[model samples]
Target: MPGPLLRHVDALVGVGVLVWNLTASQFGELSQQLDQGLDRARDFVTANLPITDAQLDKLVKQTRDGLSGSAPDPVGGARTAAEVFGSILLALVLLFFLLKDGRSMWRWVLRRMTGPNRELTAAAGRAGWRTLGAYSRGTMVVAAIDAIGIGLALVLLRVPLALPLALITFLGGFVPIIGATVAGTIAVLVALAANGPTTALLVLAAVIAVQQIEGNLLEPLVMKRQVQLHPAVILVVVTAGTLVAGIAGAFVSVPIAAVAWRILDTVQRHRAADSA
Candidate 1:
């Protein structure tokens, strides 16, 4: 990665960590509450339900067995961590190599081709890159707007884990239609769990309001000329991507659509010019 891009990525990671720390503190409290509620519910059931001593003893034994069985496996956890870290390392190495040598590599490939086909290929590549770059820049702005607006709203409402939820909302903005909705739902649920129904409702309204503002104002202002896809086209692509490849597809579909559209547009314009 270039220096500026690396700096931006580091900043985003730092923000994520900050949000995680803030929300993790609140998460501890929520965990304790959940444990206490479970204990109370268990006691109430034990007190009210009709059961024999033998049955109760068996149930207790079964519960203990289940708890033991469910205990975390350190070896498995370590293996998973190692796998994740290794993948990240590999990706970084590959990206570094690509960034260092990508232009020469592309030119080498282009040199093997001849005639109009080569020109068309180069044009399509340029258009795709331009489209992707524009989308990335615009999405960053939109994500910032989402994070700030909803984060301030959560803070005003005194919602616990607000920063973490806002961070999630910002990241989710990268995905097309459904990302923010899913993240906002998590925020509302957190509010409901930590506060009360009234607070939860307020959080829900706030989430909706923020999304409305993002869709109507921020996205239009930031991404208006970046991506040329219509609303219906976006919706269809999002739906198809979601259905075919799930969350990952939904996240990437818009960019891929933009690139494809750019390529097509470039081809058409070039052909028209050549004819003229």
Candidate 2:
């Protein structure tokens, strides 16, 4: 009996660790594109070197027809915000539910397991709290660090829309690989337009280097104490999640995987003990 109890506890503890891992890497999906940069330097050279002054003049018709009466792109700086009104409303609603009733809901789950399964119930609760707390805290910190770093880089580059881009970066950083990749791409693309494709390429390279440092060096140091999973497993889950849930699925795949791993692993170990 004693051995069974200890094993059950061990399994739950492991689950707690898994949850933390998912929470921390939310912004990494976006970071990947940043990692594999756009190779702007090569492109810039190719585009510029191939053309002489006269060729450029011919293309732009000696800058006469090019600048004759061309008005600015009507769509530039077009919308107030790219995020739709509905996303904002949904976020507010989710925040309310989590803040006010999230705890009670877990208590309700624990309450549903009848009879002598009380210990199992408690284990589940521990797993839930660990998942929620670790993911929330880790993701918040990572996103903040990412946003600040990228924002500073953009500022140094004298990129326009720095503040708006920073805010977008912070929000997107919450989504893991895809989020960072998309957000940073936006930054680079915007930079390209504002400065030129060459400058944008440089900005893109900077984003990738920063992400590598964060993932290879910083993440391991910080996450060692949080949750641990093999890299291959994470890749599989991310892929599967994108297939099943699209963006939402991809964003949430880790936490769900963590919880599933925790719950299933816990139950299995306990069952083994019972049979023994």
Candidate 3:
């Protein structure tokens, strides 16, 4: 097997083992905590809202039955696994070819264009490439900061599975806004289950503070230099990408938008120069 493929396989196995151990040790405890929390919530709702105890009980029972009836199919699980494996294989192949032939490929593309258009295309391509590189580096820095900040809070709170949760946060950071939110929610829930509501609230506060700093300070400082984008534009692009292509789309949307913007800016400048 190729080195990249072997590395990917190793990573997958490591993650699987980590997840298995976490589930094996903590599943029962988490479930118990969840049940207790739900009971407390039910009581509070019954006292505050216009619902009767009997109605709340019926609603809870129906929800549980529905969840139980919706257990995942083994065949579907196997199929999804196969699809994931195939995607990894395809990505590896593409990466290898791109690494090996990128310059030649770019030259080939340039050869297909003519005169000023060729120069414009080359300039735009270079700008887009630079934007992508900047985005990747800046994102990694931001992600690392997020993971470290939250992971430290988890450790201070004595949360279980802190390492694995931190790893998830780091990976999730790649997906931008949605990714961080989901990862933080998981961390908060784990804190609630293992510790209590107070710990959970602290965890929530930590997550929010880290995310806000990353969004307002870190990202603007790191990304604005090369990949200038408004927060509203980023949100819109992320939402549209999610609607169109789910998680994969969300992961890629921001970089794609940034690169596109850089390329358009380059083209416009070239056109203006010619006109002048």
Candidate 4:
């Protein structure tokens, strides 16, 4: 097999193993953190939306009755709000580095494209940089879009911890086959805990609908131009990552593609040079 292809296959297998182990061991922790955050979220939602007019009237009466002396109702619980904001900040920081320093980062990789076949090195560098950059930016956009859309859904549904849930969605969107599912599951579980089983089920259905839209429509339309790996390859890599290092392995697959691509391009260049 070709160098690049073999590397990709190896990575896929490794990542699949990682993710599976992580899911089995850590899903409970994710669920737990989600539940803890939901408490604040529930209060935030309930306080914002009192179902009945009498509830609305009560709020006005309380405010008029000198409730201004008390602390205002927070939008989310401390931990939940922290989770939401932290994720957004983390993603934005990643975006900043990707957009701003991508070329510089690739220049380091360019150094490896050296020796007698300098032209080949340059060519591969160009291709590698372009391919990887596109993937990075495209994935970021997909994550952002997913987060916003689902956040709005949660808010409208009056689900607690909308922002935190949205953050999870954004991060989860990065995972190929299972990222969104894991993230969406958190939202559903929260809905179950904070609201009821029916509400959780409905939330799960909404997540499924959105993911279908993203997979069938957005991924092909958006990421296709950026990332050249086939959907089958992507799925395999994710599964492999999950199996190997769990979530961490799955997250590393796409990033490693650039390296895998570079190695392939190098081998291709050598073959052409030899033929020449």
Candidate 5:
């Protein structure tokens, strides 16, 4: 709606596109390397495996038939893309509306409630929003640190496509446990392809170190201000969330838990005071 907002959005869109294109190009090269390796492995297996000529021919035919039967569906792909784009557009519109009138909407909702329920609702809303904001900011800081640490490590080791991989790592950090693992694996694979297994192992170590630091130091220090959760509790909730709702649940589980705790604490204190 404003010039500054428009400018910020434009800049972010440009940067996102640039990063995506660079990463996609790197992935294309990586895919080719993977294909070549698979081909070599297949050749070796065929050469060494004990089988009659007719049996080998039958096996190859069966594999080819299976692959052909599982051909990519262009229509399905297009439909999925359209659905995703539509959902994104809808979310942006809703976000804009919320930003424009969120306070008024909240006030109106509060007015409709009565007595203790209204007060409790207001308190819960405040706590929930605060937890969400704190978690969002702290998570970004942690992700930035992770990206920088891993990216610098890659650069020091003379790994190719360090920046693109770092960008991916940063984005992946938002997805919680699975995201970082997948991103780090990609970096290791790239290192293995460009350098060697030795360099790849080194990269793997660096990734593990960075993740440990983030989990042990960065997250606790920053996130404790808003939400103090035991590591075991977090693990259980995260696992449950991932099972229930995939990435979105994993991303939000902690914040939701924190907010719920805050609300319960508030309610308990209110009850204690009323009794006194």
Candidate 6:
């Protein structure tokens, strides 16, 4: 678990750095576009709304000044960094102990149980573990496919920061439906800002095509056997998890659901066999 999670964190950091560099390199052009967009917005508001040009100008100025304000407090930043580091350290220590003693702990639990109950417990545990493993592998395969498909389209469209965008897509693919949509939207916006409407539309179409293939074809083929949950069920589970616990909940929910389903199935099968 920590292995895959650490890799994800690394990927996220890489994507962030790449995106930051891309944005920095294109800052001048982006600023010009922003100013032009603001001008258009002001014109539209002045023409259609009750607001005066002076009021609009003041609002825009305030917004711009707020955005361009001084950097964040170093002390607060340091405190946040320390907290993050402490959390990571604690996680690593827990991971170490779990890795070292998990099997022994499982055996101890099984030893305390008796007869059919022990057998059922063992079977359910094994099933849940297998399901979780299958989910991890299947998700990675699907994410790779998404990243590759979207990256190729961006390359063909000559979109700037295509690689970083593709990396973002790959990372987003881990979160299932919602992640992919957000990543695609970011790609479309970037294309629109950098390459205009036609290219942005093309990118959007490609994203949709890739996502369709992922959802309708790749997911069913790759994940159905492992997860065994309906698309709607997965969607609902993800949504509930997100509402309850944000990104961490969303990330873990599907695997938890899959494992729980497998465990229940295992227990039911054993019960039926024993009754028969």
Top of the candidates by lDDT: 3
Among these predictions, the greatest TM-score belongs to 3
For candidate 4, write residues 1-276 as lDDT tens digits: 456856875896796577555455555655675666465455556677756556755866787778455434565457656775787799768866765676677677666667755666666667666676677777878888888888888888888667667767888877866788788878887787776767777888888888888877987788675466776877888777767755667987865764476658766977878899
Give the per-residue lDDT of model 6 (tens digit) for 1-276: 468866876896797787677656665554454455445545757999999989988988898788667434789769867876797799779866766677888899999999789989999998898888888888989998998999999999998777667777888987878899988987787777677778878999999999999988998888777587877888999999988755767888888989999999989999999899
Worst 10 residues of 3 by lDDT: 29-38
| Model 4 ranges with Cα > 4 A deviation | 1-116, 239-247, 262-276
TM-score for candidate 3, please give it: 0.76
lDDT of 1: 0.79
Q: What TM-score against the true fold does each predicted structure earn? A: 0.71, 0.59, 0.76, 0.56, 0.75, 0.71
RMSD list, candidates in order: 7.6, 13.2, 4.8, 16.9, 5.7, 6.4
- Model 4 earns a TM-score of 0.56
Runs of candidate 3 exceeding 4 Å displacement = 1-81
Which of 2 and 5 is the better model by lDDT? Answer: 5
| Alpha-carbon lDDT of model 5 | 0.80
In model 2, the worst 10-residue window by lDDT is: 76-85
Per-residue alpha-carbon lDDT of candidate 5 for residues 8-40, written as tens digits (9 for 90 to 100): 778978988987877877776666644554444
Tell me the number of clashing residue pairs for each predicted model.
Answer: 0, 15, 0, 24, 0, 0
List the global CA lDDT of all models.
0.79, 0.67, 0.84, 0.72, 0.80, 0.82
**Deviation in Å, model 5, residue 60 alpha carbon:** 18
Relative to the unseen true structure, what is the C-alpha lDDT of residue 3 in candidate 4, on a scale of 0 to 100?
69
State the weakest 10-residue window (summed lDDT) of model 1.
Answer: 33-42
> Which residues of candidate 6, in runs, are more than 4 Å off?
1-88
- Which model, 3 or 4, shows the larger TM-score? 3
Task: Give one digit per residue, the lDDT tens place, for model 3 in 1-276.
Answer: 457966976896897688667656665655565566555556767999999999988988999899778655899869877876898799889877876678899999999999888999999999999999999889988988998999999999998767667777887898877789988987887777677779889999999999999989998998877897876897899999988866777888999999999999999999999999
